[model samples]
Target: MGKKTTHKFKAEVSQLLDILVHSLYTNKEIFLRELISNASDALEKARFKGQAEGAEDTVAPEIRIACDADAGTLTITDTGVGMTRDELMRNIGTIAHSGTAELTRLAGEGKESLDALIGRFGVGFYSVYMVADEVEVTTRSIEPDAKPVVWTSDGRTDYKLQELDEDLPRGTKIVVRLKEDLASQFTNAAHLKHIVNKHSNFINFPIYVGDERVNTIQALWREPKFQITSEQYAEFYKFLTFDPDDPFDTLHTSVDAPVQFNALMFIPKHGDDPFGMGRENRGLDLYVRRVLIEKQNKDLLPEYLGFVKGVVDTEDLPLNISRETLQDNILMRKISSTLVKQVLDHLAKMAKDDADRYADFWRAHGELFKAGYMDFLNKDKFAGLVRFHSSGLEDEKGLTSFADYITRAKEDQKEIYYAYGPSREALNLSPHLEVFRRKGVEVLYLFEPIDEFVMDALSEFDGWSLVSAEHADPAKLDKFESLEAEDKPEPLSDTEKPVLDKLLARMKDALGDAVTEVKASARLSRSPVCLANPDGNVTSSMDKIMRVMSKDSSIPKKILEVNPDHPLVRNMLTILERDENDPFIEQAANQLYESALLLEGYLTDPHALVGRVQDLLTKSSGWYVASEK
Candidate 1:
């Protein structure tokens, strides 16, 4: 054995060490993940190089993890092109590897396009000491002529390397001497198995904990697209999502461009399960060239897509000071932005490729798309992926693209208009949509409840505004010539008009001034009346859901738009005229307003309307006895 020679870290490593030892990583056990990941990377590299030489022996396949608690040690070994003396000093001791130096040297070299050649380094190696009091590396190059070397570090300020002759093997072995307190973690085989399974289970290589293979997962990201069968993706989705249901949509892509990355992402068929359990999803995982970076990296996807499961492999992320503290990391941010763009772009293509399939995806995960549309922060991209049902399409409930909406728009139409209802049938009957249907104008039918806020978030798509069908002022039709005007519905007689007008004034008094200039409604066709928010602060759909769930929230003052045309309105007018002294007229007015609300998808007590209906029935029958009560 040679004398233990120690050398200090390069400035960056020294700065990085302070960060790692202090608070860069939230958990110390991630050291195992980092070291094991490096072993896997090296093993994969050896496998690639071995393929060049036609070496297919399983003996030197890739990676193996062995734990020795008696010595308080955990060893990760890889039969790779192990480091030579100069390579060890350059790679391990000084951080002067050609890859790092070349990156710095060529930094200003045209957009810093060194991504094709550069991968991560240094940090993943030093991370071992977070768990181990001491870390030792025994390595031998597969070169037939090169000798073996060992490197040792306590992760303080220095490390040492020397020539070594062990039970002669051509590979690299990392042995970690666990701190006395942490010894029990590796002492119990089950605990060690847990860490490996959680962090490194999908490592492309076979990882053995004692005699059993612990990492049985396939690194599906790197496999060729054609080679990955749907069965494989489905099986992988089960493991990835931990759900029994099949995927809602799966996107697997390999790109070699601005950077090299392999990614597999799946939109789960069921988010309600985990969400119902009150689980906060961690979003899609992050990886680097097939090595696990973090199993639940939130930054890899938006919060709305937190239920999705998959892996993103980028070879160029800096691994932070500790591989664990990757939030808001510079390279990670860039990668995340790029990933969002890619996912949105792919989804847009999917929608364009097959309308039926994409509509099915919309049916399965439309809320997520709406959420992304609202808050994804990638507006331009998300705008393309959104799908909706439009009355403009040929079939009932047939879907239309935003682009299709644009194309079908009137020559002078400067905005896209949509109406919200609980059902397409309901929308078709909505009093608010009367003029739109008469004018042959198309409206996107927003059946979803949250789409009101979602549209507010989206605001506009491709320079066209999103206008709500409910709140669009009929007076605003002054902007365009009335398409056609039929005779106004027969007005109540002058004698009856005063009573309705007087009653409407009283009803408006009961509702607030937010009701804005209420008169007999021109919009109603067959409906008695409908409630509308004139200011558009809340949609009727939103009001219904909130009132059902929240005790403190009062239903907003809704404008009662009554049909002077409908038979119910006519009867109310006649009753008001016949009995100016009758309290039943006022009760009918209140019930009519409330029933209008019910029609608008807002909740209402039917007993109140039913009681009023019976009141009128009893008054007409002249059965004002105890039987009426």
Candidate 2:
């Protein structure tokens, strides 16, 4: 041995090491990831230096991991640029001192490709102390004159360094004497391979656990798009997500401005968490140079796009010392905005180019994607992508986008009309849609409870206000001519207007505070009555959903709009004309109000309405029998 020496660790270095071994990493297995990543970085530096010198016989770079269960030890060897004694001290003997960062600084004025280097915080290597009772590093520098050196440390207070007399191959080898408790976990070949595959599978260098190479999957996102085939993408996606089915769509994009990143995003053929049971763990696997920094990082994408699964590798992110979490949220937000735009642009292109495929995407993800209405930055793009069942469609299965609806809309239409109900059939039967149907106007059907909230957030799209049919103004609708002229009931004969007024007064009196106002509606053509929001504080759909959520059985009072032309209302007017003080009048008014409540999904109890129906049946049956006699 050439001279063996001992050195005390910097005070801060000792403090940081304690943190790394005790509390820094959530998963101790990632120590392997840190070592492999450092090895990869060394290998990349060697490759870049060789390429710069036009070297043709450079050694092929590879990482080899050997697990010795009997010895309770794990060894990792790499064919890369080995560290000089000075470099070893500067890189590993201090806290937050990074070899990769030093190389970057030295290559600053040169046109060097140092971007592949992964170690920036310098603390990653210390993570090995998490699983090791003692660690030894044996390295021989690629420089011909540099002597071989060995570094040994128990990772507590001090370390020893020695010059080796034996010749060794270029690069570094790490031998970890595993902690007694963690020996079996780290010494098993299969477990070691799993750790490599999980964190460093896409590393440029081949990673071997024993003789078998574990990282067989290529980093397709780094490869040129034209060179990668659809089959390859599908294979990679299946390998990444473990989804048996092929993706519905794939978005492979590289962004160079504001932030640089390689994103390989996929819209799965179907959502794995359709019911949102496992939605808590959502977002892309965040990687820095193909090393997974965070898995299912929820910050990578908005919650609305949680269904999207993929990998996002960015070198520009400033990671915390542990490399487990991001340090700068501003940079992350920029990346998020860029990703949102890319996804939106991809979907928009698909919608325009492949309607059938886009329709499939919509069907599989529309319920979740509809939550994007709150993404105000991309509101226009989101508006263009949302699909709805419209009155114009022959069946509920057919869907129309807002753009398509606007295209087919009458020139005078300024509002995009939508109504919320349980289903298309329910919406079709909605009393609020009577006038819209008469005017041959297309109304979007909102079936999901979130649909109302989505519309409320969006408010408007492409200069057209999104107005609920329940809130449609009567005068603006009357301006549009009826699609087909209907034989009209003459306005209650002029002399009978007074009787209709008396019936309205009687109905309002019967309803008491159950209604804000009881008034004849010019918009209603078929339904006897419908409720409208008195002051628009809450929409009918939202109110019903809120009530259901709170388990409140009480019905909210609203404006009752009665159609004078409907036969039910005309008959009620005659009933009032004959006997102004009849109990049937109050019963008939209450029955109409309750029936409207039932249609609006607000009526919790039907006992009174059912009894009234029975009484009406008894009276009508008796009258029919007397007529037959």
Candidate 3:
């Protein structure tokens, strides 16, 4: 053996080592994950080289971890492309290879250059000292004639290099003498197995602790889409999502040009919370070369895609020195943007290729998925993905997208009409949809509270504005001449106009500030009365949502449009003509306005409306008794 040589670590390296051992990492157990990950990378490099050189039989690449409690030692061995004597001196002995000085400079300058240091610097090996009192490494290069090299460090200011025994394998092995208290924890086979599985379960090669293999689960994300079976995907999805049913869709993608990554994402057949969970929690696991770096990483995917669960493996990620979290927000954003696009693209294709399966996805996650319609980055893309109950498809299961809506819209239709209500059933009964149904115009039924905000965010789709049915002006349809001449109420007859005017004036007086104006309705065909937001920009749905959030109980003034042809309004006109001061006429006018308010979901107190309704019923029942006598 050559004489052992000792080399002093650079001043900066020594300082970094002290910090890494005492305070750099939050969890001491992470030392095992870091070291094991490094070993996996080395083994991968060796395998690639062996394939190119046709020397595959030289050694079987595997990672074996052995713990000795009595000896206070934990050793990790891997058949990998080991470093030569000179390589060891430069890679570990000097600070240059580890980028210690650069890291220190960046840290002193603040975190602006953090990404540069974390992504380019290689200092994970030093983290072993966080738990170990001393660490020793034995390595032999793939070259047959190369001598084995051994490096030892007490993790202070210096390290020593010596030659290993000739019979040592052509790989690298690290032996750590754990600190007194940490020894027992590191030596426990079961404990170490857990750490391995938690951080490195999907590592390509087999990982063994003692004689038992721990990393049995395959990293399916790295595999080709063509080779994977649906059964395999279903099994993997169940494991990841904990959902017993099969996934509605699976998006497995591999990209290399801009940012290299492999993603295996799944849309579950059902969601844990269909509406929303009221928080942004990303279900995607972030991995580097198959070793999980962050599990359930919220930064990996956007909040809108919270329902998607899977793993994303990429070498392009820039991880901090601890390898616990990502350091590059710019790179992470790139990955997230790409993922959002890919996932949306897959959904769009699924929607087009298979309507039945797409409908299944819609039923499962559609409520939460509508959140994407407001995503600024993908609003237009999401426009095609959103599904809604429309006048054209009255069935609850028959949802129409904006694309279909545009296709079915009447010629020269400049706006896409939609109505917001408690549900499809409620929207079907809404007075606001009377004219839409009568004219054969399709209006989207928005059921959720968030749908209004989503529409406001989207504002427009495919060059057409999203106009709310409750806010749409009746005169806007006159140009389309969609309402047949017979369908249009004979424009207030010269003689009947005065009676209609009298009813409007009485209603306006009774409602006071409750209504901005009470007008004759050219839109209503079957309904007695309806409320419309005169300020077209604010839909009734939007107003209600704002009211709830701001805790504002005061109702905003709305235009009360009364259908002149309806029996209720015509009778009110006749009653008003007979006796303007009649108490029943006042009760009747107030009832009309309150009922409209209730239908618009703006009625704050139902108590008053209920009393008015009781009064009307009592008066009508008495009138019926008199008629019978």
Model 1, 1-629: lDDT tens per residue? 54556678776565444444444333566677776777776676777877898977465456667777678888888776787877887777654443434434434343321112122344566666556788888888877767788888877788787886554677788888887887877657788788888877777777777778888888888888899899899999888777887787888887666566778988776554423353355567776655555667777777666656788887776543233346646767776777777777777778878878878777666765577755547877777777777777767757777778999877678778888887788888887887677666778988776677677778789998888877665655435544667545676677767777876776666554635545777655656777777666666666666676776455466667777777766766667667665666567667777666667644445787787778778776776575578
Worst 10 residues of 1 by lDDT: 110-119
lDDT of 1 at 236: 94
Candidate 3 regions off by >4 Å?
A: 97-120, 164-166, 278-281, 318-329, 479-496
**Per-prediction TM-score, please?**
0.75, 0.93, 0.90
Clash number for model 2?
A: 0
| lDDT values, one for every candidate | 0.70, 0.84, 0.80
Candidate 2: lDDT of 607? Answer: 98
Q: Rate residue 419 of model 3 by lDDT.
A: 86
Best by lDDT: 2
- Supply the TM-score for candidate 1: 0.75
A best-first ranking of the candidates according to their TM-score comes to: 2, 3, 1
Top TM-score model: 2
Number of the candidate with higher lDDT, 1 or 2? 2
